[model samples]
Target: MVDKPKFNTALHEKDGVNQPESFSASSIANITKLRRKQPTATELVQGILNGNKTALSRAITLVESTNPSHLEKATNVINQCLPHANKSVRIGITGVPGVGKSTFIEAFGKHLTGTGRKVAVLAVDPSSSMSHGSILGDKTRMEELVKDENAYIRPSASGDTLGGVARKTREAIILCEACGFDTIIIETVGVGQSETAVHSMVDFFLLLKIAGAGDELQGIKRGIMEMADLIVINKADGDNIKKAKLAKTEFNRALHLFPAKNSGWQPKVTTCSAINHDGIADVWQIVSEYFEMAKGNHYFNAKRAEQNSYWLTETINEQLKSSFYTREGIAPLLEQYKKAVQNNELSPFAAAQFLLEKYFSK
Candidate 1:
């Protein structure tokens, strides 16, 4: 069993967790004091920039927390890291549950670290809130990778989203890149076909699948399959190796049937066994090949630019809605307006105008 101190030390080095010690009552108190002190966003940003893992983890926690005061700090931290961001490869991994995502990532991360690359994994499973728990368990499953000097694993901070990825996974990516992690892998919360949130934020989107899930071509709903850069058939070892090969062949043929993605990168399908660590290196090679091809075609930079633009527009729209609804006494007015609109006493446009008028009059 990995001792708590060693685990904390490994993660601390990767994330900048300062003053690592055994978790005790004093440790809890110290963290509480830090929270109470509420270091200015600048101090927090400096800590993060200095690669203080504790501070980085705490900053993410603040961003993920429900506390309104922490929102300002979180935004500041992201802004500080923004210019240094977008340099890393953000790969989103998603599949149905039991597709060996966590296992595959552990092996894949090890492979990257071995090749002198720094890897950071953000397991996004915001649906975890409904269960009040993390679904994929990346930290526990990737124990070896977690202990590696060149790897970082951050669990999904709970959020109100169908895909367990937190709303701030984008922000986390920025911070990860700023911390010098070259490969940022995001694992989506798999529950049916709603894992598309990860697709938009990543440079390469990978979909994992088991060999004989009956329907080899499990055309995922919500159009997510159209977004995949690569499809991996995991669990390719054991007596299932031949079946896995067939599955890969089936998926490759299925992929050809679809129109190429808007990015002009044709999705590649391959098979792997995460349990025995088979074909892991080949998987990384495919990702690198995609990068080279996309870079040459000018799709790589274009995709990141597009992602940033979308996030900015979406953030502004969400902020506008939030600011309108959260004002004091706005709840009652909102309720009143809802009923008026429902009863045809007012059109939605008229009701919105009235709300705006009232809000500004105050």
Candidate 2:
């Protein structure tokens, strides 16, 4: 004999009518007003200097925007913030997929925040080919760090950037520093050539690896390994601990084979368990030591100087290419030249020269 409890079906039913709540109109009007009132560059800079996260976020959005008006505003804001930037230590973290980069970042970020460091993580996510939108799932993955008061996490779409980083990541770093974050972590999308892009912009570049995966250097390129300032063998817990140690040993040996870095510092390999929060402190300690050594040798400032020059040249080249490609008569001419080249009617070099001459003639 079973007794059945009565269920209320009426409560689950919704009336075929729209309900309006108090303050709805006012809220809508206020949003409309706010949208109409774009803040000035001075106000945005002041908000950032005062550590207003909302202002920092909006400023970053402006920087990432392709709109001409937004670009002009973003440039103004960056110029105002430049004097307050460069106070933070920028660290780049990269590895192949399934290397637990998100987990490691959560643990490492918590450790830094526990020591009273204000940390900001800029995670670049792969863009969807069809939608051109970021997966934007890193915030969910780094749950612990996302909740920390001393931590700020921003996920950006990689867009068409070949390095698996957002085009405006360097500008985002400036915004983070202007907002008083002392440690900026740039997490790349773990794709080809991303490590190179990140290394150019960071003070320390870290590569995370795993163990028991056939060859110790399975998916990673040797050139990427050479760029790492610190190599960490993660997942060093339980059954994988011994394998992690062996991988660390192998990495150390391989690092020794590379030429010395310009900073005069030797790259180090260590092991850690991001899941268990083991050996995280050791990695931070190594970073601090490297900073001390590099600063003592004046390489820190010199590296930033070189990175600035590199970006300046890269920007000029990009603008020149953009201008050339977007000229009024270039698109149609380019299409014709492309067809001719594909049909073997014109050699590639001759087609290119023809296009250049046509472009210059205009």
Candidate 3:
């Protein structure tokens, strides 16, 4: 030490003082915790294949991530899981906001799991426009299902468009299937007049409706009704039973108005009280029958193959649109063009053309 002091910098340079550990115990613990939290894609895939819900949730988080790095890892995990998917029955459940879609799904999922099927539910919550924040309350709403070992519930924000949420859901289904969930349920909150995005991904589309005054037959949307393989009138308890039965009959009549579906499966209507768990078994029976018939007639695999093709095109369109809007120098120009169009300085079609040209130029 004395010889090192030959330089004589700042008088006494001493290595005599003892130093504390470079890392505290707490810090080291935290680092370990973080490392455990972020597992590798290979570990995640193995965990998922072994039916570990923790790994499933983590992989799904990666899939829903917007970070470029996370997305690449997500794609890797998805491709690996793709081979294990498609063995499950993907069911889409949608309804008006107040029609108890979550409640119905809970009851229906419980019924399914009771019949020896592993169920995974992907619930899409609407985002607030002002803050773009989601409630993510499906897990809270489905208390029993959340506790069921055989059932898994994942809630996702709908983000800006139904298409975006649907895409994430399609990916989530693959992950869940790879995890050995045989029955997949997708729940959407209040898809206005049409739920075409949800309809395209699921094998069976179940529309839930509640009994209301003059809102049954007169207020139904043709597009959504046409897509439904089964309509279940929920909350048919106490005083609502008669009204729900009437709604079911009206829905059945309305179903006949549309031309036959390509699946050659006639749409059916039933009533159930989700809160009271009445007629829940019947709903599953109908669903099971449809699956049986679909698989028997070879429509089941055909529909799934068709959906795969549809999602391929849908994904390409989504990526291209996202790329254009997120490119450099597009936001300010888009605002300027918006103002110009609003003032009638440029037509919307022309503004769109200009934006496309600018996007391509880069």
Best by TM-score: 2
- How high is the lDDT of residue 58 in model 3? 92
| lDDT per residue (tens digit) for residues 136-171 in model 1 | 467888899989988889997545665666877878
Kindly report which residue stretches of model 1 are placed more than 4 angstroms away from their true locations once superposed: 1-35, 126-136, 220-222, 333-362
- Which regions of candidate 3 fall more than 4 Å away from where they truly are? 1-37, 163-167, 219-221
The alpha-carbon RMSD values of the candidates against the true structure, listed in the order shown, are: 11.8, 5.8, 9.9
Using lDDT as the measure, what is the rank order of every candidate, best first?
Answer: 2, 3, 1
Error of 1 at 125 (Å): 2.5
lDDT of 2 by residue, 12-88 (tens): 87558776775788889999999999889899999999999889999999999866557678999999999999999
- Which candidate's lDDT is highest? 2
Give the TM-scores of the predictions, in the order they appear: 0.82, 0.88, 0.88
Please list the C-alpha lDDT of all candidates, in the order they appear. Answer: 0.81, 0.90, 0.88
Report the lDDT tens digits of candidate 3 across residue range 1-362: 35543565678667787878887999999988998877889999999999999999999999988775687899999999999888889999988788899888888888888888999999989887799898899999999999999999999998877532544888999999999999999887675845888888899999888897566964365777888899888889999998998888888888888999998999999999999999999988899899999999999999888989999998899889878878999999999999999999999999999999999999
